[model samples]
Target: MDSNSFFWKIQAGTAATPEAVKTLGGKIVRVDAEQGSVETSFEGKRDFTNPTGAIQGGFLAAMLDDTMGPALAATLNEGEFAPTLNLNVSFHRSAVVGPILGKARIVRRGAEIAFLQGELYQADKLIASAVATAVVRKQAKAT
Candidate 1:
């Protein structure tokens, strides 16, 4: 990893992780900045499950968003952030409360927009997948 890369800074603890990421038990596993791809892991707590004893679709969607967002974020400049403009998700199989794996990549990138895709898996079974568009924005300078 390039020492100056944003993801590197995150791994070095020089960046603040979003509360939503922490709440989802998100952990960065691998990054390929040149390829605009990333691998992430998440924990699906029991609280995330629905009455059917499966992790709710909303929680799975959030995991996919977290994964795809970071794939774009990893390639961003220090002052840039990407917020999802739209996310389309497909649920394959029901996920249970446990460890889940995520993989994401940037499909295309423009000066102000990015297209991304990601997948979620549990015990090697695909649980969900998503494609998303995000708008890249510059952070406001702090006074």
Candidate 2:
């Protein structure tokens, strides 16, 4: 793991994973900075379910956002961060309360922006997919 990589920092416990990610039960599984790709696993808790007992679409969207954001974050230089500008998600099949795998990769990247895509899967079935754009920004230095 490159020390400069944000994902590596999170994995090494040098930096804290966000509370929202914790709520999603997210864990970083693999990262390939050169390839601009990452794999994450999330526990879809029953609390995330809707009236149909399936995971709510909003939670699934958050999972996808968490997935795709890291794909770009892993490649960022130290002291830099990317905030999602827009996320467009499509729900395919309802997901149950269990382990869900997320895979994401950078589709394109420019100096200041990146385009990303990702999918959520459970039991080898696609649960949802998403495309997102993010703008890279330098972290503010503490005064």
lDDT for each residue of candidate 2 in 31-136, tens digit (9 for 90 to 100): 8888999999999999999999999999999999999998998888888899999999999999999999999999999999899999999999999999999999
Best by TM-score: 2
Supply the global lDDT for candidate 2: 0.92
Lowest lDDT block of 10, candidate 2:
1-10
> Relative to the true structure, how large is the alpha-carbon lDDT of every model?
0.91, 0.92
Candidate 1 residues 1-143, lDDT tens each? 24664656877899778789999999989989789999999999999999999999999999999999888888887777788999999999999999999999999999998999999999999999999999989889899
Give the clashing pairs for model 2.
none
- Per-model TM-score, in order, reads 0.94, 0.96
**Against the correct fold, how does model 2 do in TM-score?**
0.96
Clashes of 1: 0
